[model samples]
Target: MEWYDKKTYIEVYPPKEFSFYECIAFLSRSSQEVLHQIKDGSIYKLLKIEDSLVLCRIRYEENAIKVDFPDRQPEKEGCSLVAKFIWEWFDLEADLKEFYQLASNDGILKGIAKSYSGLRIMCIPDLFEALVWAVLGQQINLTFAYTLKKRFVERFGESLMFAGETYWVFPTYEKIASLQVDDLRELQFTVRKAEYIIGIAEEMVSGNLSKEKLLQKRDFNEVKKSLVSIRGIGDWTANYVMMKCLHDTSSLPIADVGLHNALKNILGLERKPSIEEIKEYAANWSGWEAYATFYLWRSLYDEAI
Candidate 1:
């Protein structure tokens, strides 16, 4: 058992009602996330800000969350950047109480809120990483997707050793965009996937796409259109990026297997809901569709729900 680094405590005050442990549970959904270290109910992650790789440990403490980096003391600007990234990544400012109020009338969402009250959407906070992860998960089981992610990160990402363990940061666009398709071949990337990954990275490196630009869009539809215009991005991928990366609560990928399975299990249906059926049933969700989907996805792990 790993524990928090008490010698280097830094405090982060959340703007809205927050639950540190609940957020960790959401981030822990995938073991393939190499960038984070979760130990003894606290979460640690290596954040790459400019040229510095800052290692942070986060846990609940009083009204504000506590963060500590054992290796060094970060500058004020670096600490601010870390706080901003964490705020967005955990959606600390989102008004989930309003979402809960909305869910109160819906069947599935009501149960979801009751089961996981303070859970927030965990975001990658990096557009390139989110896009690549969405592509890697296409047409495959999550287990295999995680395997691919672990391999890809270890192959190209930067890392540092802390307390005898290595912490990794995702590869930068500059490094990945310069690579040829042949570079990822040994990782078992389908030729098409390799091309797609490289193509997206190239666009990012060229300033054609970015999280800032995407966030500038007016609505979910506009964001979806912009994302789908990029090669290798389709409806499902676009919706996923919008929901997870952009924090668009209205974005919902109706075709997600987890959504289907979760609905089937919750509603006691013998088969998964059709896209048409989901649309009809989810019509009442309106602006809360993403939360609805998230809660259903959580049902996969939380049996008590």
Candidate 2:
């Protein structure tokens, strides 16, 4: 991520193929989103950099992402952290050329990839957020998933009121680590999910699970295995975390409902694909399964799975 600190703000330059519009379309899909607010085509997010809670106004302009702090700037290191956050949030480091080339001849992704050429995987930079989201979305529809997320964030997250609306920061594991299962269940979380969330937070607090640790195990299989070893994370969730949080390009959630629906619609199948069928279709995807799944998910909607 190439960036420059301009005293009051920092500017990030993305690759030529990066499409801010497409990412915005995906971000705008859920009106219930609380962690970030999109208004007037600019995204406002609250991030806690070390000790300072920084509010940044992010917009793509002139092929660079302009991040402006509404109140005041932080230390130089904080500026770089914010830039890195934005970089990972957009998954800007990925070379899409390889993925595009692989999709060009595929039976499933050729057209879908072209249709959403510039759309990057809207990644969740926080490991906890990504893992919790996967849990919340299990066996639920996207709208309800967003509903759950909004409720959860509003209940436990921090916020700052700007203009008229509020900008939220996702709840910190440090905060949630002190919570009990009953607390989350009161917010409409299932008992299982509440336990999983609390347990995951506790694991992080105990230094048992951290994104840094996962990144150290660069082997895709090793990372996936480590994630799946966690009580709440299954193969689907592990693959999801790998793709969204660890930035593993080969991770694929073949059982994802959105992927199945997208494939059914794209292939004109009367019914959704079986697990075996999806594997057969995905065989050639190899190292680009994450991108392929993302583009296919885009075909279902601008929802940005």
Candidate 3:
């Protein structure tokens, strides 16, 4: 097992009340009994309380991340900054007004927004990790992708134990880079996924890809272009990462199977639309494409239920 630590401080606006468990529920990647896992003391565990910041440790199967707190309690003055980090990491506090407006303009999107109000964009600071995950998820069901990820993480990640539970941190680029394609395949990843993951790691290690620089770019298209320059990263994978990890509001994944199916069902089309058809349909969404995509995904989820 291995241990890693980081300090996170949240500023509450108007001195809003906070429930630590609520925050954990909002931040978890998986929805299947995630809240129950936290309550059962298997996933996230509170470590210490300090002033306005509450310190905690997040436990996975074999890894742990330590979260430290600030010296003072939250207040209105620091709320936006605190909210930004919290939402970026776990909470969804972006310009909901804009999202609502976009949703209201479309019937399908409106229903999605109403049905899944808690859904929010996620941001991962590690570009390599995001890219690799996207690669692993391609052309496969999310359940299978998650299973592969859980196994890969447990096998390769560093872990730590606090109280009685364990926490895991995603494996570093260096750790994954050292592995061969066969090693990843043994962990349940397809050969294509293994190659893509390693290709991304090698490029990052060799200084061919710089996530920081990409984030600094003002134009989202430029960032997407740069990301796709790496081998095995196509339009869908690149746009997905840009929206989820880079927080680009304009990034829309039109090629996703879920998105296609959702649009087909919502529009009452005779068949699933092609990628070109989805792009043409999304022309009206423009600046709010990410929200549109989110709503489409939600629509699909609602249909499944």
TM-score preference between candidates 2 and 3, better one = 2
Tens digits of lDDT, candidate 3, 135-254: 878988877887887787778865545456555556678788889999998987878889888888888888778777887777887898888888899999999888877778788887
List candidate 1 stretches off by more than 4 Å: 1-8, 15-17, 303-305
Residue pairs with backbone overlap in model 2: none
User: Each model's C-alpha lDDT?
Assistant: 0.84, 0.87, 0.64
lDDT of 2 by residue, 1-305 (tens): 22334357789999876889889888887788878888788898899899768889899888899998875687999999999999999999999989889999997899988877888999999999999999999887878888988888888888877557677888889899999889988888899989988989989999989999988884988888888888889999999988998888899998898899889888999999999999998899988899999888778774345
* Pairwise lDDT winner, candidates 1 and 3: 1
Better of 1 and 3 by TM-score: 1
Which TM-score value belongs to model 1?
0.94
lDDT of 2 at 71: 57
RMSD of every prediction = 2.1, 3.5, 7.7
Model 3 lDDT on a 0 to 1 scale: 0.64
